[model samples]
Target: MAASSQGPVNGVGEDKTSVRRQSEANRKLKYISLAVLVVQNASLILSIRYVRTLPGERFFTTSAVVMAEVLKVLTCLLIILLQKRGSLRAFIKLLYDSIFVQYLDTLKLAVPSLIYTLQNNLQYVAISNLPAATFQVTYQLKILTTALFSVLMLRKSLSRVQWVSLVLLFAGVAIVQVEQEGKQKETTVSSGSQNYAKGLVAVVVSCLSSGFAGVYFEKILKGSSASVWMRNVQLGIFGTFLGLLGLWWNDGPAIAEKGFLFGYTPMVWGVIFNQAFGGLLVAVVVKYADNILKGFATSFSIVVSTVTSVYLFGFHVDLLFTLGAGLVIGAVYMYSLPKAASPSSSSSSSSSSSTVSSSSSAHSRSHLSNSDADSETDAFLPKSVLVK
Candidate 1:
């Protein structure tokens, strides 16, 4: 009897040790993912802003978008291949099965893929014209759009706080737009084809597309059994085709005269790689981070971008822009807060508790799925790293 008791105690101690190790591992992942996220978010915007503002032969934004798509597809395929234990045969079969065998399901992704491609192109248009700091602040409107679409498309209910946050988000973006418009008129000198009005329209439309595509993607994800990387592989395929079509339509004449890769430079290549890597980073963050943490990363990134912009681009942040940016940052944090669980009545407390426990288990299983759906909507933009 004494021996049996000791065995059980030793087993309990081992279990505790295992749990502690797991906890420590998770904590490490969370912080590391957060740091990477903050850096990726800031760098992508700054790089894009820097590249677009450089005076000289500019790389074609349409071609850059297409190349980014190509790189993304390759990256996703590599990931899926690794998941299949580096078996090329297995990877090819899986891709063929998922992409070709399941034709209808693959076709469904075409919708979000097209929208994402358009959203990505709009990103260059917006950033080229708007200041990086201004674009970052204004781009948070995607959250408002996402929330609205979540309600309409997914029939998801929002809390009172979330609704109030959305209103504040809109107000903040409006204030920033007003300030930008005023600045556009006040400046007499030409700022190298910078058009605040065009940027404003582009960003607003991008936000709308971001929201719809994100929610639509999420809705479809809920019904499917595919992995996130596999879905991305599908998106990359569609995005590449759509991006090329766009390139032909917008820059056909220019490309014919100067080649598809005209004006390519080392800086241009860095930007393309950064954009592609940002898309992959979103999946990592979604895996290791939660909504609240992701929101904090985003808010911190805005501050970093704004401060960097002031030093790098001599960006002047007036009082109005400051206040507006503050509001947007706050709204983002508020919106990410989880809805408080309602308390159960005393009479049925035990039963309610049991039900809640079971439901929470199910929710945890689906948590990653929900986060992935949300991330892709902003993947190329910034919400994900920006476009994610």
Candidate 2:
């Protein structure tokens, strides 16, 4: 009788313990995800800063980009191999079978991949010419451009709050640019105006390309059941091809004169690896978290990068620049908020909650069965013992 009585109690205790364990596990996972994002962002910033300090007439931008693409491809291939249990024959067979369809689908993404590669090169140019903090701040303009592209390509409509946030974002970026220009005027740096103009143009083009590529990539992802890693492999394959073409177009004569990888160095390899791995880290974060979390991560990274730049590179941060950065960060947060709950969504949530409650009640009933059996057994016991 005592054993039966304790059965339900112990079961409930076990359930509670499991719930607590799961909750703690989830909290730890969130922390780990955030740390990955922060580290990746810091690595990217440091790599770019290192690259900008290199003294050379040759940037090796094309070669670095191609190497990054190749790294991505190899990383994806490694993942595939692991998934196939190290069966090279199976991997080769799968690749051969999917070659035609994958290539066709990859071609669709290739155009945007090429655009993203160009944007990547432009980012290097902007960072080389501008302070890291300033470059980071200006890159936030991509959010506004992305919204524009979503409207055009995805037929998505924005709420009034979203539109207001975009406007604030734009204003904030403009203020930062003005502050940079004023500082340039006061410094009397050689070719300051020309370099600033070039940086500004590169930033704008990068934003436009990023917006289009992001929206197009989203569309592709939604249209297919391919895994994220698979899609990345396809993009990397095409990106490598496009990088080769770009290298030939921009550096063919130069390569002939100086040979390939003339400007290569350990630092160059560091930059390439950082860029490639950073992208993979982003994919991992996206797989584990929502876009809202991703946005927060990026905003936090911007703040960290800005502060680090001030300390390490002696970046000037005036009142206007601070205000602009604050506004931009605020806008990003506002933009990431979920839209007002629609009636349909509310109703669905209500139904889901009801279902959950029903399941919980059913589970409780199941647990009470042992107690019910105990009660039945208690009926067979003496009345004095049951009271005890």
Candidate 3:
């Protein structure tokens, strides 16, 4: 090929075009992930809210909660299935061999995932009881809670501006709570007191638990070598089994009665889709993105749930709720400011890289220690570490 006047023929500027295209491709991927996350969370919220409408709702409402738990198991299975077959076997064998790793490696994540599950249930319960918009406002407190846990659990600090914005977010939460108190309405149900009380307690606990889990997952990935999905899959599986066992022991097989064995309906599948895929999507997001950035991405769910409830169900929106939502939105943006890359940030990034390298080395040594025909196959799988 002959050289053109503008360049060293095809070779000269090829790299530049390739670089530009790659950048654009990455940007596109980020946008796609964001879309996936919003849809998933919105579906999840919608399904949970639907539980409130079941006639003589207590049984169905509790069953809905159980269904959510089963979805966690489905998430695990899906995540594991998504991995390379070799990787799955290697990870499984490693777990099978070490009792400590099995407990701390697999089950440890459940503590935090359970926390997240609790928060999620609480949000649904709250929405089921209070005005729909009220739950939206209080739920915005998640950004602040996640931010706080990131600092405490990860020993990662935010900038002063980020802290200020988080403070504003809390203020927003307080504003909504106070406003909702003033606008509280009289209940019509006979056992309104018991229902609302149990619901409120559940909501608060679940939200805090989920918030802590979000922080924990991020920290865990920094210290571990597995892909984001690996850790999440493990956590989801553990969490699902735990939740199912607990709920089954406490309640029974009511939600399972709604399972897709007989002439099932779209509503039932919608619930399954919401819990299964929705749980995985949010879990992946929590694993990959920073909580601050995640807060912005996920806040769209609030809008979706609110619009659906108000227009679809004729729920009322209050002024204080609006203010609270605004605060959360603002807080998400503020926290998302590119952290002024400090020594600490650089150090954390470096440590994460080192952790991956060390884990890789450990995996290589283990396979060599085995020194067999399957060693090569095992070596292909990435190693993982147990992190607090």
Estimate every model's Cα lDDT from 0 to 1: 0.80, 0.69, 0.54
- Clash count for each candidate, listed in order shown: 14, 0, 8
Model 2 lDDT tens row, 172-226: 9999988888877554465342377787798888888777777777765554545
Q: What is the lDDT of candidate 2?
A: 0.69
Superior candidate under lDDT, 2 versus 3: 2
Write the residue-wise lDDT of candidate 1 on 135-208 in tens digits.
89998999989889989988999988899899998999888888877888754256847878788899999999
- In TM-score terms, candidate 1 sits at 0.88
RMSD of 3: 8.7
Of 1 and 3, the candidate ranking higher by TM-score: 1
TM-score of each: 0.88, 0.83, 0.70
Q: Between candidates 1 and 2, which one is better according to lDDT?
A: 1
Q: How far is 54's C-alpha from truth in model 3 (Å)?
A: 4.1
Which run of 10 residues does model 1 get worst, by summed lDDT? Answer: 339-348
- Model 2: colliding residue pairs: none
